[model samples]
Target: MAFREYKIGTRMFGIALGGSMMITLYMPSLTIYSVGVTETGLVKGLSYGHNSGFSYEDPFLQGKGKPLTVTIKKDPVTGADIDPVDAYVYVPGTPFPSAVRNPGILGTEVAALSADDGQVGVATSDEGAVFLVSRGDYEGETFPYIENASATRDWTAAAVLASAADTDKRHVGSGKTMFVREGCEVSYAAS
Candidate 1:
């Protein structure tokens, strides 16, 4: 329910989601694909050891997988994009951000609920922390445990193993845990 500026060594022991949360992503360099035509977008490979890289799998899509088509939003609330072809997170609907262990929304949960409104600040390149996902209520989401880690640091053996475990339980349709982390992103997508 609170937003903190992600720094290296920021403790993300348990967030709403147990995988990578969205970090601040610049729209121009990033690329994101929309899910089901306008519902939401997923970042590829965001699960670190689990997802396909910056992209995350949507648990509600009948099966587990991320979006396949690139999308950009023109709505001012989502932000303005110089290039229409790019999946720009700064623009509110862009995608393909830097892959980290437990990806957290780029900023506060409210920003996340609406989309990464760049509340923290704009990035020249992909920057910030990856909030770890845990199966507890974090701003109202649930799943695995992903630690907020440094962008440059490599994942520890334990972290990687933990991520794999979370991925397994998270993608299941019944619980729909991934939504804990993705709830806001999906909400923004719907807008």
Candidate 2:
């Protein structure tokens, strides 16, 4: 009925790839939502965060009303944010799949959209794809798509993501920076 915003807990409860990514299984039917919403951010105690400091670590990308910066992962070994993967694309939502890491499951194929508004690229990783989402709380944001060399926070459509390298063009997804968690909101994953 509603296309909720995504957060760190939004990843499905199916299989987890490495630690940063998960193969979606039970989060059925994702194309696009006609309604708008806002997802809560991760809380850190109760200092009223974000000045050292963010309200919470929101990974989803957006550019509607609020402007968000993309989160980059370090090499762990290298400790640098150089040439980051940006984002990862899953199945039906992203038109291009070969450019990113394949979940190698039912997600390998894109589902046919009925009245498609077309899909844009988002992002993910292989180790722990902790998908986060919003149940009507994350305003001015949506999923993140990393295949574009940068996050999709600019709100560009699928066409802008393409280029000379077909691979780069096809690496589309819903993740630009961030899905579901728990408590009252996180439980929505199961529902």
Candidate 3:
């Protein structure tokens, strides 16, 4: 007894069946979030008990155990990256917790950052945080949390988990397949 109204500009195109027009529509959304630093020249690895590494895991997609292919945006956003220093908090006034934990996405999340090029992966988890302050001197001093982090200083990205269907490949019978293709560029955070 309840009907949902489609928004204007909504693409409703599909095959005609049973003397009636059958239309299918898919709505996909992308989220970009940022890991901002409050102070300049702040030490990168303060939360993870280190001074030289950064890493995080998406809690939502832990069990899937699939790696996501991340690509940084060609043009970095302004104020997207920040320099690290030894401070009580990365964001001014927001004191660092005794321990920092990675808060992952709700539906699907990133598991880990790949060693090469820093692409994220998905995996299994009982209750771990999605993002985490990494360990080691290489990532801590060399890498920024966001893409082109050192240059841009800010890291923002779209959630890229391979577990999600990147493309639509549904077969509705009748020698025809129905699917919705989704595309997104890897950024630092969800907006």
Candidate 4:
């Protein structure tokens, strides 16, 4: 007599063929069956057994759009506990292509990270927006996050105040006089 094993998913079963008898067994929780065979290889046995096992849906093939969230955080001092600040966020108006508004979405907003403490959160809205942040000496730079959807240039100021509340940390000079080389205008919402 010889035995063969077959596996499907996590279950295994065995089949045995003898001179005139055929036995089938399911394992781990073995169930046995006996049958009589003719010379022609035809076997008489129970037609249907237990079920073919459980059916499962493919997990990777489903879902669409699926909302996303992102958060960004920073700390100037290593150990001292400091409240997280809300950075700037802005999205430009839709652009016109050949004098027509394209069918894309755009938006921008600034929010603090959740209490759980994380870096950045990217959320999906029906609208798409470019998020921008200003830091160090480049604080004055300002431009729409999504500049007309197509323009990659960011219009920014030449200097930024490291700490707006402290005069000593100003990015331009050491308690020094400076020139305002032409005036520039920027529109942004402060948190």
Candidate 5:
């Protein structure tokens, strides 16, 4: 019996070859395939869109203490309608505020608008602005919002609809909870 020895990470293993005139073999690394967590302790397999507005702690405005309000407009009396579904607000150095729950006053309907014909106001303690985005607008269909020193974004419409379609889904257990928690609402175009 002919024996072939291989060294893997300071350990040696032997393989027996029997009656092999010509054969091809492939050896892959023994590292476990990662599905979620990365070496840097961050979640993997997630993508984000672009930054649409003023970012917190922006280099241009350093040490300028001022609370900024971000409004998502649904209609434009003078120009064009603004879709609230295509907007996201990012507050750097702070966690994204949970979407206020209500019937229509201020909830995560994704259709809520401010008193103005086209605006959803978002109050920020820090200097930041709202980011306007659309489905599949940037590299990925996800919107990347930086908050609490971490980067997060809204899930695409496909993901949201899929989550809502599931019957056994619950509010807390549902994947679309982020949409509700983030006060995401939809806005319709005025006809």
Candidate 6:
């Protein structure tokens, strides 16, 4: 088996939590390949199995000897680059679940989305609990959903989401945000 690896170094600038901040992300992964890699950007590596893997977005298929660089823009609302509070990277040949989003289906829970359109959803066990999803790409950024303030509980879920209503639940895209309220049970899934 041929071992192909990719290393990505990224720098971000924007406003987060009402302050200017800069962040850097180091990402590396290995894959089994014969040749060729093209697309390059920050992606949530998904679709992992023995001898192969896939990303939510198309993986850069450029051949070896290429350097991948990415620049994260500022949040539209806050006008500052969001911080990647819970970014993660894989070691090339790791086993992971798919990051695709299916409506009303349960998926693996991750800290953040690695690629754009990485599917994510929320579930709640508590009654009257609601989650708000922000409409934006939240990959390489940190947007935590506060479960309880009095008890001081936090979840590494997505950020800046639309409110998930008791009657209607929806899936959010990668780099988005979510907030839970009213003691509702909330869980996230990715394809």
TM-scores of the candidates are 0.19, 0.15, 0.16, 0.14, 0.20, 0.17
What is the C-alpha local distance difference test score of candidate 2?
Answer: 0.23
Candidate number with the higher TM-score (2 or 4): 2
lDDT for 134 in candidate 2 is 12
lDDT (10s digit) by residue, model 5, range 1-191: 66654456224222334213213332211122212112121111011112112345333422122111223232212233444332232333322222211113222122222212112243332433333322121233232221211112232222332332223221220222245235442121110
Write down the worst ten-residue block by lDDT for model 6.
61-70
Q: Can you write out model 1's per-residue Cα lDDT over 1-191, one digit (the tens) per residue? A: 77867753355544423333434343422443211111122233332123232334443443233211123223222344424321212211223233321124322332343223222122222332323221223356532322222222232223322332221222222223355355423322222
Estimate every model's Cα lDDT from 0 to 1: 0.28, 0.23, 0.23, 0.19, 0.25, 0.22
Higher-lDDT candidate among 1 and 4?
A: 1
Query: Ten residues in a row with the worst lDDT in model 5?
Result: 42-51
> What's the CA error at residue 110 for candidate 3, in Å?
22
| Poorly placed runs, candidate 3 (over 4 Å) | 1-67, 78-152, 159-191
Residue 63, model 1: Cα distance from true site in angstroms: 3.6
lDDT of 6 by residue, 3-71 (tens): 644332122222342233222221211121211121111121211111121233324411111111112
Two-way lDDT contest, 1 vs 3, winner: 1
The CA lDDT at 121 in model 1 is 24
Q: Worst ten-residue run, lDDT, model 2?
A: 111-120
Error of 3 at 62 (Å): 7.9
List ranges where model 2 is wrong by over 4 Å.
1-84, 89-152, 155-160, 169-191
lDDT of 3 at 17: 39
In model 5, what lDDT does residue 91 have?
36
Ranked candidates, highest lDDT first: 1, 5, 3, 2, 6, 4
